[model samples]
Target: MKITVLGVGGMGSRFALMLHQGGNDVTLVDGWQANIDAIRKDGIQANFNGKPVSAKMPIYSPAEIDQSGVKADLIVVFLKSNQLDAMFKRVQPIIHKDTYVLCLLNGIGHEDVLSKYVAKDHLLLGITMWTAGMTGPGHVELSGDGEVELENFEPAGEAFAKQVVSVFEGAGLNPKYSHDVKYSIWRKACVNGTLNCLCALLDCNIGEFGKTKQAPELLHTIIDEFAAVADKEGVNLDTEEVYNHVAATFTSDIAGHYPSMHQDLVQNHRLTEIEFIDGAVARKGEQYGIATPYCKLLTQMVHVKEQLVGAK
Candidate 1:
């Protein structure tokens, strides 16, 4: 399989290396010149399951992709939500009619932008439980295991979606063709909405947040806001069930882990996807006339933190 990965951060680099090692032709594209130059000079460095593994592959900036006229069988997007529109437009030359685009990004409203780039039948929406982090340019920390649940945007894309799933399976990415990926996406959003945001604000890990006395109440209120917004979007999120799923992460293997948002906003001093995650819910709540005070406040607080940290 030919694959092009957008945004070679921790998750993007992890997927690229895995696919490359899995015997697929993988090329990387990112907006970060430092990352591209680092990989170009030293290849990708990873600590996989506490063991070192490294691989070098073709890397390109978005402008380079525009000039190279590179095309792929699959375009795997793992970019930050804020970079989606500009990146997608920049990479348009690679997106041919039959080229499938699989977006495993965290949050909602991605399909709106993606649909403008590809046919509905060629768009595959997905969510992953996998976790990864970048220690530096061209360096990543990949540990633990996670599953991917994805579905085609249109019924006509089923066969190709399964083929893509098979490719993921071969690459050691646990893939499941979900009958209701929207529910899964919403469930994952609930996880990010509570744990990811709170962890960043509180300056703690999942377990640390979970150990707090206010954890349960905070989780309930935020998830209820998300469920109300999701209901308006036609995704029926069971509040208790979704809350349990997210709360389970507190005691799970990644108990000490900070979420991607924290890695971006707090550690890296970079902008986060809060606008797409919690902020998206808040915006939609306004649209649907649903009160989402928790989400609204969290989104505002994340931005305030962004300002304090001088995040771009």
Candidate 2:
């Protein structure tokens, strides 16, 4: 299989190296000059599965992807939610009629954006429990065990979904096909809405946040809001199940790891995907005549912090 991974930061690079070493042709696409130079010169210096390892493969920027005229059977998107529109536009040269597009991006409402770029049968919706973090240029620290749940966003697209599954399995990526992936996506979004934002605001990881007496209390407010909005959007999320899932992450192997939003705004001083997570829930609440004060306020606070530091 020939694959092009968009947004080759942490998750993208990790998957690219895995797939390439799995005997598939994989190309990494990123906007970072230092990361591109490092991989092209040395290799992808990744701590895959908690062991120090390295893998070499092609790395290119978006412009170079266009100039090189490369194409792919699969295009996996792992971009920051805010960068979806612009990043998709830049990677136009990779999409073809039969190309399958999968969005393993965090949060909700991303299918609307991806639908504009790919046809129904060629579209896939999925979420990863995997964790990866960028340590530096061409280097990532990937640890622990994670599984990917994927489903065809379009009906009758099962065959194509299986094809993508085979590729992931070949790379030792535990892949499962889900019939109710929307529920899964929303469940994951709820996890992010609770963990990512609060962790960012409190400057802590899952373990640190879990240690607080108010952690579950704070989670209830956000998850209640997310549950209401998700219900209005035709996905009924069980509050108890969702809460348990998010709470479980606190004791998981990656509990010490910083959530991505913290990695963006707090550590790197970069922009966050607040709008895509809690903010998206807030928007849906307004549309459906539901109040989402918790999400609204949290979203606003993240933005205010971003402005205070002039985070991009």
Candidate 3:
């Protein structure tokens, strides 16, 4: 398959390398000139399990993508939500009419924004439990297992979802087609809401947060409020199940790893997805006439921290 990865940062670079290694025609696109130049000079440097590996493929900036004049069968986007608008605009010209655009971003509301430019049938929503980070430009470090759940929107069918899953599975990432992707996305949000914020606020990794006394209590509060919001939204989410999942993730193979949110704050980048996880729950809680004081407070605290750090 001819694949193009837009926003080739951490996860995007990882996916691009995997697909290329699987023998697919892969091209990596990013806005950063240093990353593009580095990959073009050398190769994509991927550190997995503390061992370094490299994959040679075409890497280009958005401008270069425009100059190439090549179309892709599939385009996987892994950009921050704030960059979505401009990124889509830049890539629109290169995307073919039949290209399947899969979004592997965190949070909700991305599908709606993507649909405005692409056909709904060509859109796929995805969620991942894998943890990764960009160690440097054109370099990515994989911290744990990569598992993805994907599904198509209203105009797509199961066959399309399976085709998308096959591409990821071929690349060694365990990808599955889910009939209820909405619930899966919500579940991921539940987990992210409980842990990511706590990690950012406490400046700790998953295992370290689990070891703290206040971590579990705060997590319980966040999950409880989030579950209430999900229930009101008619999304089936069990608090106990969600809590157990969050707890297990800390002890899982990815234990001791810091979440992307924490990494963002440490790198002095603005954390926007907090608005999608905790802020989303709090907003829905108000609409459902449920109290979400804890969630709201945490969201405000994170915002304050961002303010102090001058994060964009």
Q: In terms of TM-score, which candidate is strongest?
A: 1
Q: Specify the highest-lDDT model's number.
A: 1
**RMSD to native, candidate 3:** 1.7
lDDT of 3 by residue, 1-312 (tens): 888888777778788887888888998888878888889888889887788989878877776667887688888888877788788888877787888888888876788789887898888888987777888877888766768898887655457678878878888989988888888888888777877888888888989889887877887888888778877767878777878888987678878787878877766465556777788878878888999998899889888888888887
**Clashing residue pairs for model 2:** none
Query: Candidate 2: worst 10 consecutive residues by lDDT?
Result: 48-57
Better of 1 and 2 by lDDT: 1
Query: Per the 3 Å backbone cut-off, how many clashing residue pairs does candidate 1 have?
Result: 0
Query: Candidate 2: where are CA atoms >4 Å away?
Result: none
lDDT of 1 by residue, 1-312 (tens): 989999999999888988888899998999999999999998899999999999999899988987886898999999999999989989999888889999999998899999989999999999999989899999999998988889999999999999989988988999999999999898899999999999999999999999999999999999999998898778888899988888898899888888998899889999999998999999999999999999999999999999999999
Q: Name the weakest run of 10 consecutive residues (lDDT summed) in model 1.
A: 62-71
Please give the lDDT score for candidate 1. Answer: 0.92
For candidate 3, the 10 contiguous residues with the lowest summed lDDT are 264-273
